[model samples]
Target: MSSTLIPPSCGRAIAVRAGGLVEVVDVEGSQVGDLWAIDVADPRRWLSTSHTRDTLEQLFPRVGQSFVDQRYQPILELVADTSPGLHDMLFPACNPALYAREGSPQHPNCADNFVAAAGQAGVTLPAVPDPVNLFQNSAPDADGRIAVHAAITRPGDRVRLRALRDITLVLTACAVDFWPTNGERCTSLRLDQLDGDGN
Candidate 1:
């Protein structure tokens, strides 16, 4: 198994072979991480949150379920999750524009982090899609009001994912300090790229 640590307000991209597992660890409680992936074989058919939601007919991710692409192709599988399972797929990745709207024009965000991570992975895309906000606590009420709150993930909690195809994985240590998204503070994350089976 290989591991990488993503510091607070930073991002990193890695290649996950088919059948390989990527483990994301909540080093400290109340931290959120953005997870995005694109298939190397077909870039145009990247991971689609809408498709996944429709496929599962659910909003939140579940263990033993695969996150699919726009073409309904499996990309990554949520093999295990130890957190509170309150991740969000409805919200877009945090970006500078979002911060600017909130009165913080120069705040660091996940959109820029994805670009940097993609560059390091030697891959490019036409647009940045909404990522799976790991450890995030977002709930929608009966009236359709979504409230974002502090994460419930405890220290050392982990979420494991399995790659269903050759793909590039990008992760960002969410830097949203202006809200309770990161408990009003940013923190580091740990990513472990585990070998397949006996390899």
Candidate 2:
């Protein structure tokens, strides 16, 4: 397997064929990563977290479930998870406006990261879609309040996913530093392209 390192607050885009296995690794742990997938054959069909949640009838997908696209087509399937099994799909990717409101204008956020990465890959996004917040620790409480917390993933924790179709996968190491998110410290991540059928 070959590994690609994503420095703190940075992003990357990789091409994956159908049935390809990609593993996302938290190199230092407690760092959140925003993830998105766009169809290579049809860039219009991008991974929709809301669609996946609706199709799975759950807040987040299980290991065997697949994340669907806006058209309700499966995009990527969760193959394995070595983390604490904590992820969030209800939140939108962080953007400049959000950071600006937090008094941190021009901060590098996941939304911008996706745009730049996808642009470099020659795929134009229709919009900044909600991402699968990998390693994020946020969920609605009984009172319907979604509170963000630090990720519980330890060093080297990872989640492996399989592409159901040709895709352009984008990922970003979260950049939040003033909040409990990412343990108030930005960190790096890694993406490993493993050979074979990921069995």
User: Which candidate has the top score in lDDT?
Assistant: 2
lDDT agreement with native, every candidate:
0.89, 0.93
Off by over 4 Å in 1: 197-199
Which regions of candidate 2 are displaced past 4 Å?
A: 197-199
lDDT of 1 at 36: 92
Stretch of 10 with least lDDT, candidate 2: 190-199
What TM-score do all the candidates reach, one by one?
Answer: 0.96, 0.98
In candidate 1, which residue pairs clash? none
The TM-score of predicted model 2 comes to 0.98
Q: What is the lDDT of residue 146 in candidate 2?
A: 96
lDDT of 1 by residue, 25-111 (tens): 999889999999899887777788999999999996689998999988889999999887889899999888898999888888999
Candidate 2 Cα deviation (angstroms), residue 29: 0.5
Evaluated with TM-score, which candidate comes out highest?
A: 2
